[model samples]
Structure formats: C-alpha cells, structure tokens
Target: MANNTSSSRTDAGALVRYYLLRAVVAAAWVAAAFAIGVANPVAAGILLVLYPAWDAFANARDAQANGGVRANIPQALNTAVSAAVALGVLAALRIDPRLVLVLFGVWAVLAGLLQLAIGVRRWRTYGAQWAMVLSGAQSALAGGFFIKSAAAPAMPAIAVVAPYAAFGAFYFLVSAILLAVTTRRRGATA
Candidate 1:
C-alpha cells in the first residue's frame, strides 16, 4: 500500500508538471504565431515545424517519465507520429502551406486518438483525467476543422492555427489544476 501510494504520488507530480509545461509551450507558440508568424513567411514555416516537434519531444518525455515506451504505447506512438509530422511539415513548407495544414490535420487526428486512449487508461488508475479526455476529443474536432480550412481557396497562415494551440493550452492548464487538486485531496486523506 505504501509503495502504491508513493507511486501514485510520483505519477501525479509528473503529470502535473507535464501539463503545466505543455500549457506554457502552447501559449508561447500561439503568441509567437501572432506576433511573428504572420509577418514573416520563414518564421511561419518554422513555427509550423516547431509545433509538431515540440509535441514529439513532450510525448517522449511524458512516456519516459511515466514508464518505458513499451508500457505507454499510446504516447509512444504519438511521439513517433509527431516526429514524422514535424519532418513532413518541413518538406511541405517548401511545396505549399496547404500541404502543411493537411499534414497538421492528419497529425492532430492521430495524436488526439492516442491521447484519448492514454486518458482512458489513466482514468482507470487516476480519477482526475476527465479534462484530458475532453481535450483529446476537442483536438480531434479541431483537426477536422483544420482539414476543411486546408481545402479553402486562400492559403492558410500560421495565425489560422493559433486557436488550436490556444485550446490546447487551456486544456493542459485545466488538467494540471485537476491533478494538483486531486493530489492535495489524496494527501489530506492520507
């Protein structure tokens, strides 16, 4: 029982930290997109590539912190997918912005499904994963919207995707808060 409690506490702490970091990164990305991505095409391209690269790095870190990739298959797959998407974005930027949007949309859909699976699995062990589940669902929906936008006549800009990052930031913040609250309550009870 003691070991289980300690493990749970460790997991909770790691998740809280992960969510907070993810939120901060997303917020900064959105700010940068609005402030720089709009004015400079090169900056916009870099931002597009960085978004998925960050996701890959974040997923890898989370998977490693939680358990080995084998134990966290969903996150592991997400990390791989995000990494591939980052490379795809780099290639697509040279061809067309629409391609970048399409790649992001596909990545978002896949990553969101993986996130949903992770949230469901975690919910069995930790009760405060509702925010994560909701975030995953919202992410999938946003991906669909992105796909639709990609088909539009006008070329999509990095600013067009800023709202997705904003929502991501909000969800991560909520998850962090939820985990922090749950940890406090568990500590009090213990």
Candidate 2:
C-alpha cells in the first residue's frame, strides 16, 4: 500500500512538471517571435530549436522511467532531426528569411506528424494523451501557415519572432503551473 501510494505521487509529480514545461516553452517562443520581427528568421529558428532540445531531455527521462529503456526512441530521434533542421535554417537566414521560414514550416509539419504518430499509437501509457495530440496538430497547422506566409511575399509585415516568443512564454507558463500543482499533489499524498 505504501509503495503504491508513493508511486502514484511520483507519477503525479511527473505529470504536473510535464505540463508546466510545455506551457512555459510555448509562451517563450511566441514572445521571441513577436519581438524579433519576421525578418529575423534566425531568432525565430533559435526559438523553435529550443522545443526539440527540451523534448529530447523529457523523452529520455520518460524512457528511463518506464523501463530503463529508450521507449520514446522515435520522439527522441525526431526531436534531434528537428533541431538540426532548425539550426540549418537559422544558418541560412541571413541570405533569405523567407527561405528560412519555408524550411521551418517543412520541419514543423514533419515533426508534428511524427509526434502525432507516436502519441496516438503509444498513448495508452501516458495520462495526457490529448495534450500530445493537440500539440502535434497545432504544430502541423502552424507549420502550414508559415509555409503559406512565405509563399505570399506581398503579405502584411508581421513579425516572425512573435510566434516563437509567444509559444515559449505559453509553454513555460503552463509547464510551471502544472509542475507546481503536481508538487502540491505529491506533497499532500506523501
């Protein structure tokens, strides 16, 4: 009974922290995007890169927790690839922001699909399956929008940085809150 209770508390803690991280990261990226301006594709790319890094650690941790095995191999691999692509886009931003954005959009779409595939198929083990699905869908849609925006060279002067900064901000905020709540729950149970 004691062990079970402890395990439950542990799981709750992980859940809360996960959500808090997501919220914070999202909000920060959105803010960065808005502040940096659309022309500053490098900044935007940097912001996007953060997500994959964060996810890599999170996935690795999760894999360890589940069975000391790299269970989320696909997620980890996809995040790595996404990060690399984002970096490559950033490197080319000086030449053309539009090009960077287009690449970013492509990366986002692929990452979203990969995440959705993993989440849908392996959701039975996770408590926040919907959140994963939602995140994946959002990524796909946002990627598409970015691609379209790049295609429309005559479109309004919107800041590309806004999306990234705002996303990071939101991600961090939500993640922090979730972590706090989980901490409290864990404490109570403990």
Candidate 3:
C-alpha cells in the first residue's frame, strides 16, 4: 500500500513536470510564430511543419513516461497522426500552400479526439484531467471552423494558426496547475 502511494506520487510529479514543459514549449512556439515566422515565408513554413512534429515528439515522450506506446494507445495514435500531419504540411507547403490549413484542420480534429480519449483514461488513474478534456473538445470544435475557413479564396497566414497554439498552452498550464494542487492536497492529507 505504501509502495502504491509512493508510485502515484512519483507519477504525479512526472506529470506535473511534463505538463509544465509542454505548456512552456507551446507558448514559446506561439511567440516565435507571431514575432518572427509571420514575416518570413520560409520561417513560417518551418514553424508550421515544426508544430505537428513537436506534438508527435511530445506525445511519444509522454506515452513512454506513462507506460510506453502500447499502454497509452491514444497517445501513440496521436503521435503517429501528428507525425503524419507534419509530413503532410511539408508536402502541402510545396504542392499548394492553401492546403496547409486543411491539413492542420484534419490533424486538429483527429489529435483532439485522441487527446480527449487520453484525458478520459488518465482521469481514471489520476484526477485533475478536466482541463485536458476541455482543451481536446475545444480543439475539435476549432478544427471544424478551420476546415470551413480553409475553403476561402485567400490563403491564411501563420498568424491565423498561432492562436490555436496559444489556447493549447493555456490549457496545458491550467492542467499542470490543477494537477499540482491536487498532488499537494494528496500529500498533505496523507
């Protein structure tokens, strides 16, 4: 019983660190996209592609830390989807820049659903996953909007996508804080 408590504490600590890291990276990416990438097409393209690749890497790492890709199937699938989206974005950039938004929309919808599943699963093992679940649902809704907007004649700029990252950062930060509070309360009560 003591060992279980200790293990859960360790897991909670790791999750806190992971969430903080994710939030920071996402915020930084958004800042970079708006401050620099927006001005330079090349830079913008790189940032666009990097976003999903980073998500893939982040998801994969988180899955490994939690219980490997096999145990975290939703994250594993998210990892795969994100990586594929990265490649798709790269191709779209070359073939037709207009396709980038479409690709992002598709990825957002799929990734959001996967994230929702992961959050639901995590909530069972560890509390304080409400923010994650909310983020996932929001992402899905935003994706539909993106898809509808993508049909417009003009190609959207990097700035249009930056806000999506901002929301993700906000939710991640909130989730991290909530988890930290929950973990602290558990410690105090124990």
Candidate 4:
C-alpha cells in the first residue's frame, strides 16, 4: 500500500511538471505573437504553426513514454490536421482582415477541441487536467467571436490577433496554475 501510494504521488508530480511546461510554452508563444504583431504574415504563420506542431510532438513523446503507444491517437491526429490546415490557410490567404480572422478562428476551434478531448480522457486520472478542458472551451468561444467578426467588411488589426493572443495567454496561465497546484498536492502526499 505504501509503495502504491508513493508511486501515485510520483505520477502526479510528473503530470504536474508536464502541464507546467505546456503552459509556459503556450504563454511564450502568445507573448511573441502579440509583441511581433501580424505585420509579417510569414512570421505569424510560423509561430502559429509551431505551437500545434510542438504540441503534436509532445503528445507523441507522451505516447512513446507509455510503451510505444499513443493513448490519444484521435487527438493527435486532430492536432496534426488542424496545424496543417492552419498553415495552408495562412499561406493561401491574401491577408485581408476577413481571411486572417477566419484562419485564426478555425485553428483555435480545432486546437481547442483536440485539447478538450485529451483533457476529458485524463480527467479521472489527473486532478488538474480539467484546466485543459476549460482552456479548450475558452478557445472555442474565442474562435466563435473571431468567426462572427469575419462577416464584417473590416476588423481592427487587433481584432484578428488579439483573440488568439489573449486566449493563448489565458490557457497557459490556467495550465500553469493547475500544474503548480498539482505539484503542491504531490509534495503533500509524498
């Protein structure tokens, strides 16, 4: 029993660290986009592309760690598809306000859904996993707003980018806090 308890604590600690790292990376990406603005479409596209790609890679790594099996194959596939579509859209679009908003909005919704799926699967096992679910929900909501704005002829520069940046930041912030709490819980149990 003691050994089992210790093992569980260790697992919880590892989970916490995982989420914290994800949050930090997310926050950094958002900050970079906000600072750079969308002046350079190529740069913005690169940034947008990298985050989901990084996440897909991370998910792959997690699967490898679990004995050569990716537990969330569907979610992984979704991330890959979403990232691909996002890049393709950005590359093909003409940088008009409407197109840019639609691209970002679509990406956000797809990514959020993937995250939510993963979070739901892990909820029973991980205490702070729900944060990812919340983040996913928020992302979808923000995406909806962006899509609605696209119907308009013109949107402010910030309108297109700000939602993405804000949601990314918020998602990361919540993820970080959840990880911190999970880490603390692990320490207490240990």
Candidate 5:
C-alpha cells in the first residue's frame, strides 16, 4: 500500500514538472508574440506557424512519455491534427488572417476536445486534472470566438490568438501548482 502511494506520488510529481514546463514555454511564446512577433510581419508569420507545430511536438512527447501513442489515442490524434494545422497555417499566410483564424479555430476545437478527453482519462492516475479540464472547455469556446471573428469583413491580426495562448499558460501553471500540492498532501497522509 505504501509503495503504491509512493508510486502515485512520483507520477504526480512528474506531471507537475511537465505542466510547469509547458506553462513556461507557453508564457514565453506569448511574450514573444506580443513583444517581437506582432510588429514584424516575418516574425508574426513564423510565430503563427510555429504555435500549432509546437503543439504537435508537445502532444507527441507527452503521449510517448505517459504511454505509447496507441494507448493515448486522443493525444495521438491531436498530434496529427496539430501538425496538419501547422501546414494549414503556412498555406493560409499567403491568403490572409481570415484563413489563418479559420484554421486556428478548427485546430483549437479539435485539440480542445481531445485535451478534454485526455484530462478525463488521466484523472484516475493524476488526481488533479480539474484545471486541465476547464482549460480544454475554455479552449473550445475561444475557438468559436476565433471562427466568428474570421467571418467578419475586417481581418483580424495575429494578436487575436495571443489571448488563447495566455490562457493556456495560466491553466498549465494552475494545474502544475495543484498537482504539486495534491501530491504532497497525499504523500503526507500515506
């Protein structure tokens, strides 16, 4: 029993570290988007394309670490979807932010739903997934907003996606903290 608890605590600690790293990366991306990527078209274009691609990489890494991609089907699917979106964004750049936003919207909705499923699945092992669940729901809603904005005649800028990134960072940070606290508490009781 004690060994089981210890294993769980160890797993939760790894999760906490992963979440924190994700949060930091997302936060840095947000900072770069606002500070440097927004003003320069080239920088903006690179940031736009990189976001989904990075998500693909992150999803694959996480899935592989937790289990094989086959075991984590949602994340595996998310990896493929995100990779496609990165390519889509690259293509859309030649057209306009309208197409870019549309692609982003579609990716967000699909990825968010997958994330929600992953969070639910991980709850049994990870114990503190509330923030991740909430983040997934919010991401879906934000995707809708992006889709709506894209339909407008006036083109939106890359700045539009930054909020979603910021929120993602916040949620990851919260999840990391929650996991750390929960794991420590469980460890004490055990």
Candidate 6:
C-alpha cells in the first residue's frame, strides 16, 4: 500500500512537470506564430514544421519519463506520426498551403486519438486527467475543421493554427495545476 502511494505520488509529480513544460512551450510557440506567421511565408513554414516536430519531441520525452516506448505505445506512435508530419509539411510547403493544411489535419486527427488513449490510460492510474481527455476530443474536432478550411479557396496562414496551440497550452496548464494540487493534498494526508 505504501509503495503504491509513493509510486502514485511520484508519477503525479512527473506528469505535473511534463504538463507544465508542454504548456510553456505551446504558449511560446503560439506567441511566435502570431508575431511572425502572417506576413512571412518562410517564418510561417518554419512554424508549421516546428509545431509537429515539437509534439514529437514532447511526446517522446513524456513517454521516456513515464516508461519506455513499448509501455507507452500511443505516445510512441504519436511521436512517429508527428515526426512524419513535420517532414511532410516541410516537403509540401512549396506545393500548396492547402496541402500543408491537409497534412496538419491528418496529423491532428492521429495525434488527438493517441492523446485520448494516453489520457484514458493515465486516468486509470492518476485520477485527474479530464483536461487531457477534453483536449484530445477538441483536437480531433479541430482537425476536421482544418480539413474543411483547407478545401476553401482562401489560403490558410500559420496564424490560423495558433488557436490550436493556445488551447493545448490551456489544457496542459489545467492538467498541471490539477496534478500539483492532487499531489499536495496527497502529501498532506500522508
């Protein structure tokens, strides 16, 4: 019983750190995107590629912190998918903005589903994963919207995706705060 409690607390602390890191990174990325993504195509393209690359890195790191890739199959797969999408976006940017949007749409859908799976799995062990679950659902929905937007005549700018990162930051912030609170409460009881 004591071991489980200690382990749970440790896991919660690690998750809190992960969430905080994600939140900070997302916030900074969104700020940079909004600042530079509208007028400069090159900057926008870089931001587009960076988004998924960052996701890949973040997911891989989170998986490693929690366990091996094998133990975190969803995140591992997400990392791979995000990395592939980053490469695809880099290659497709010269072709068309619509193509880039489509690629992002596909990536978002896959990553969101994987995120949902991770959240569900974590929820079974750590109790306060509601924010992550909602984030995943919203990300999937946003992905469909991105696909529809891509089909429209107007080209989508990188700033258009800033809201997605903003929402991710919000969810990560909430999750981090929730986990921190939970940890504190658990420690106090002990």
- lDDT by residue for model 1 over 55-137, one digit each (tens)? 99999989898878999999999999999999999999898778888888888889888999999998888778898898888
lDDT score, residue 99, model 4? 67
**Pairwise TM-score winner, candidates 2 and 4:** 4
Model 6 agreement with the true structure over 10-91: per-residue lDDT tens digits: 8899899999999999999998888877777889999999999999999999889887898999989999999999999998
lDDT of each: 0.88, 0.59, 0.90, 0.65, 0.88, 0.89
Clashing pairs in 3: none
TM-score of 5: 0.95
Best by TM-score: 3
Residue 185 lDDT in candidate 2: 65
Each prediction's TM-score versus the true structure: 0.96, 0.67, 0.97, 0.74, 0.95, 0.96
lDDT of 4: 0.65
lDDT of 2 by residue, 106-160 (tens): 7667777776776675445333355456566777788888788887656322364
**Per-residue lDDT for 36-121 in model 3, tens only?**
89888999999999999999999999999988999989999999999999999999999877688888888889999998998898
Kindly report which residue stretches of model 2 are placed more than 4 angstroms away from their true locations once superposed.
Answer: 1-5, 36-69, 154-158, 164-190
By TM-score, rank the candidates, best first. Answer: 3, 1, 6, 5, 4, 2
Worst 10 residues of 5 by lDDT: 149-158
Poorest 10 consecutive residues by lDDT, candidate 3:
151-160
Candidate 3, lDDT over the whole model: 0.90
User: For residue 38, what is the lDDT in candidate 5?
Assistant: 78
Among these predictions, the greatest lDDT belongs to 3
lDDT value, candidate 1, whole model:
0.88
Error of 4 at 77 (Å): 2.6
